[model samples]
Target: MAVSTLMFAICTAIYIAIVLFLGYMGFKRTKGTEDYMLAGRKVHPALIALSYGATFISTSAIIGFGGVAANLGMGIIWLVGLNIFFGIFIAFIIYGKKTRQIGQKLKAVTFPDLMGKIYNSAFMQYACGLIIVVGMPLYTSAVMIGGARFIETTFSMDYNLALLIFAAITAIYVIFGGLLAVIYTDSFQAIIMLLGMSILLIFTYVSLGGVTNAHEALSNMASLVPASLASTGMTGWTTMPSMFSPIWLTLVTTIILGVGIGVLAQPQLIVRFMTAKDDKALNRAVPIGGFFILMLPGVAYTIGALTNVYFYEKMGKLAVAAAGGNTDSVIPLYINMSMPDWFVVLFMLTLLAAAMSTLSALFHSMGTAAVNDIWGRWRNKKPSLAETKAFVLIMIIVSVLLAYIMPGSIIARATAMFMGLCAAAFLPAFTHAIFSKKPSTRAAASSLVVGAVAWFLWTAFVHIKESEPLGISMLLFGQNAILPMPWQVVDPLVIALPLSIITLAAVWMVERVTTTKEEDAAEKAI
Candidate 1:
């Protein structure tokens, strides 16, 4: 049943008022750049956990990748396990603690601050900020697309209008209140997300009869697998794709490993650790974040896969075909067709919250990177509150422009691309900052430059999409990819990450050997 216009209006009005109110509160409490960027470093455990978790899981996970699961099958559930183990547990327990300790030790306010201070190099800070400014909007654009698409579907509104409204509202709070507003709103949004997803889980089971019955029905869908997909090694909705298959390569390397492990180096997430009050807050946040991480994606992937069953029964077409082969549309169409009107309205808000929470973080991270790290280095001074706020508005405009211009069916791939790029370019240096001291400015610079260049070259020459436009591969190899079939489909991370690590190791070794020789010569002369 369609939602009554009255209910829709009431729900929307309430949600908007609450969002604005929280922004006001954040603005009232915020006093300076520190408060704007790091929430004054006095945030509690629950707020940090929820804010972190909410920032981590966005519409890309709930809607875009969820739709991919519908077509690809239950194997995507592996991402849920990975997200909890790597994204939350390892991130919070290992990386988060160290980041918090070292960040405070260095008076670091952003990821760039942490890196630059650890290495005592201004270039590291400036380069890191430039990268975030240039690349993070891709990720932010994905989040905006997710929320805007949902609003478009739910209200039957124009996509452009939906996109603008979503961007504008999120920009309002983030611009005025800064990180405090983002975190405060994020905690509340996380609550709504949890409630919304819990209800989605229950309804999915009820619709499919029961838990066992749902699995049984999905398992029985083996023969119904599309012949084209099966040709590429798709087996059944309940089974994993064939090993070394194209689908398998994309799923394992790109979707699962790319995002799951890449969370370690995400700039926005790293800053969350700096917002906490103490180690106790960091420790206290583990389980809360773990639970939110586990449940949200767990439910999303399950329902995503099961939506195939729902669509198959109602329309005789699989989820992908039912949504016109556009994977991005699968989840929204399923919700509209299978769910009641009230639930649709509720889920819309859940998605809106998810998108806004993540976008707020991304925008704030980008703004701080620009004003604090990049501009501060140029000026040899810290950014004032007004400068930070102005940059936040600039980032919002950049992200909105990207969202408007980005291709359709790109939300998931864009998410993966940004995450993969961050992992490739930032992970080695970021890890070294905490775990090793031998990496010099040269090593950091070489690793970052090599990692970023390798990833871009691969994408532009070897990857299918950008390669078409750039024609680097076509010019050099007379083909869209220089590699053979299996290698061609492999994600950039599979290549770039190893190269990044090796560069870091090689430079560090050279620095050590060079220093030792110089010291020996000085000693002999003495």
Candidate 2:
């Protein structure tokens, strides 16, 4: 066998061995549903931090969003700031502690369970569970696609085969070991990701003749912005797109706000708060999680934008152009061309680590939501671990099918859509569940239904890319959209989130007034 191939195979085996060993350890220690679902709420602060970070920043951020950076330029860095601020800082500091407290007090094991119990409504759990089971596969499929794309580009494997392999490996640990295995493996993967991304950043800058030189070259090439993008207010790589332009609206509102604020409502992420031992653990994890978040996107987005310069120098073509206009291909193609063959092997593992860590968490979340929150609630019984594992296998199969059928360059949009949906549907209700004293069940239910439905309708009819594919807009509204350009392109969250908040507030106020009147009447009679 060729030396490089042999070395790669050996390294891959070792990595797999380490991951499987950790999964087994988690499995051995797991004793019950609590252990499986939340690691008995005794996970180390560092493990919780690392697992949360790893799960949050998956191949979607590294490969899909990285490719976007290559096409969109440094302006995408704004998202990094938002991720650190909203995703890590606000998530852990403002929400994490209370979520853990409430989760523990209520003995809630999952996000849906927490919400349902807090609201004292079985229907709430069913609704929340349904939202997760239905919406998460879109995000999961995006992650699968990101990982599969790397494997396809790196090893010249069939995309479908790569996806199945990826899903199978992730499912083995997650379905068997549950969240315990998922988080333990996630910590291991997080380490690999940090090293790989650090090395990638240094190598990227060195290859471009240092940071200053790279930025200068990239900045000077503003004229290279494609006419298609330029028409949509793309000024240059370094600067933000024109304010209120269709492209600008999509980037800031949907891509940035949707994913950024949406992190607060993500069940997979929210469950991490419950995994920690105490408020201190959650607090201690804040900076550590923040650092990881800062590093992943800070490095990935920077390198993604800088790749444009590398492709321009090496191939005399832009990164997107050389990759045949496929945004998803930009990262894998850049790595193959610019880095050493050995590094390619290592980087491929890094991407695998990223994809697997996230896929495991997602699969675990979906499985538990399907079985414990949805089915178990309906049956008025607790589901056994084995039953949950069976459902996990089903979820994996469905997500794999989605990964196979989703169109190219669908990764980023899918991630954004799922996050946007969560933000609209769950954020208002979730926030109130944690903080409000008299959170009305009716209000929460209305918000969940209205927000989700609004987001879906907007995507089907107004989100230009999805609208055309779904053909709802074209079929109903004709050639021109029912909404105009900026409105059509603006993310659903911008519109739907406010509606959800309004619904929640309006319902809650009415409920509160009625309760006060009834209490007053009873007191007077007494």
Candidate 3:
């Protein structure tokens, strides 16, 4: 106990010192709203890439989703592919240059600002701002919960206290130094996370004897898939289930597609494009960001699946049962039981780096939305630097309170729900704004409402088996009873996103035809 306490204290001191140093540097450079909010629009591309990668891949990827992969098997690797193709490649090459150019053209500093300028609507600005203000905290709370849970598991501290401490430390840096501080710390945290995961992977492989032995051990446990889940075409981790089964639906839709395409619409990530110094900077950052995002999650998930090798060999049970059958606890249990004391200390720092890096970005985005988008719009004024700083404080306070009060499971579910909703709500409007000419404001506004409302309704009523007629897809197909079809499992994004685009195009066509007829009548009368 004494040794563990001393190790914890030492790791804590190093983390705090590094963060405070970054905060001081940010404070020294920060001069105006531009500096605080967008890193004065001069951040180098490498830093931008690191910042974007770190913010996008957080505790949710490492701890939360890693645990999920440990239970579900290699099917989740589909998400890693999606992250590479959609999250980094297309997002940077296809969308980054245009987004940066347009943001500079309009002097837009936040996502809401970009939306408002594109649509020429003050109402859109406020609406987007409100969405960020309300929606982002749910994501933030999940990150906090993941970090706190790991800390609680390792240190045996009260979970609420762990949550508060994690939230408070991140909030302080974010509140003081804003975006520049967040990115700087993120760069450092990303390095730590990369090193830590690499070490964990190496150790895990060594513990299992080698690659071939690990595969053999996993294959021997093929019958371990729970009986209740067997009828859904669920197979064990050694192989993939039949295509288009419930297991496949969860893997393809929820874990893979939900997070993969969802990356394009992430506000926190989009703003990082504006922070880069130039197109060259964006170009420089791409490989760096893509490499880190791919490697870290890939390693973590691979190690997570190998937990079965250790658990089955030593304990005569799966890691899921070894961790008391809680999916979220599997990774923690493996780390605690398999690693030595020294590496355990490093793992704690790695978890902290992951959680704090992501939390700082979320807080920065939320505060900017509140100060620059919502309050500034309502007052019909631009916020002073001092006012923006105060708004940061307010956001930190609110987020910390939510972290302290909310359940971890609830936070995780809500965070996933928000990501799906954001994809639905903003992807269409954003795509049209950048690529389409003279997009109808009526279409943009209506689509935003339809997407948000549809997501909420589906989440509340249709998605649940017990609440409504069958499942979500069944309800859409006019089925009043449960459908056993794999495709019948509907994620809100798969439905709401297509509906939003259809609504936007349909509305725009009707308005365009009406305007053309009116113009013809006016010319004839003249």
Candidate RMSDs in Å, in order, are 1.3, 1.5, 3.2
Q: What TM-score does candidate 2 get on C-alpha atoms? A: 0.98
lDDT tens digits by residue: candidate 1, 297-331: 88989998999889889999899899888878888
lDDT tens digits, residues 24-100, model 2? 88889888877888888889999999999999999999998898888888877888888888888889888998999
Backbone clashes, each candidate: 0, 0, 0
Kindly list the per-residue Cα lDDT of model 3 for residues 1-526, writing each as its tens digit: 2228887798889888998899778878888888888888989887888889889888888887877777778677778888988889889987888889889988999999999998999988988898889878878887888888888888888988988788778878887787999989999999989999989988887889887888777777778876765677668776776677777776676668878898898999999988877788888887998899888888877877788779888898877778886766778778888899888888888989999999999888898999999999989999998888788778777877877766433433455666888888988888788877687889999888898887766655545532242255445555533334443456677789889989998998999999999999999999
TM per prediction: 0.98, 0.98, 0.94
Off by over 4 Å in 1: 469-472, 475-478
Q: Which ten residues in a row have the lowest lDDT in candidate 1?
A: 461-470
| Native-structure RMSD, model 2 | 1.5
Candidates ranked, most accurate by lDDT first: 1, 2, 3
Prediction 2 global C-alpha lDDT? 0.89
Worst 10 residues of 3 by lDDT: 465-474
What C-alpha lDDT do the candidate models reach, one value each?
Answer: 0.89, 0.89, 0.81
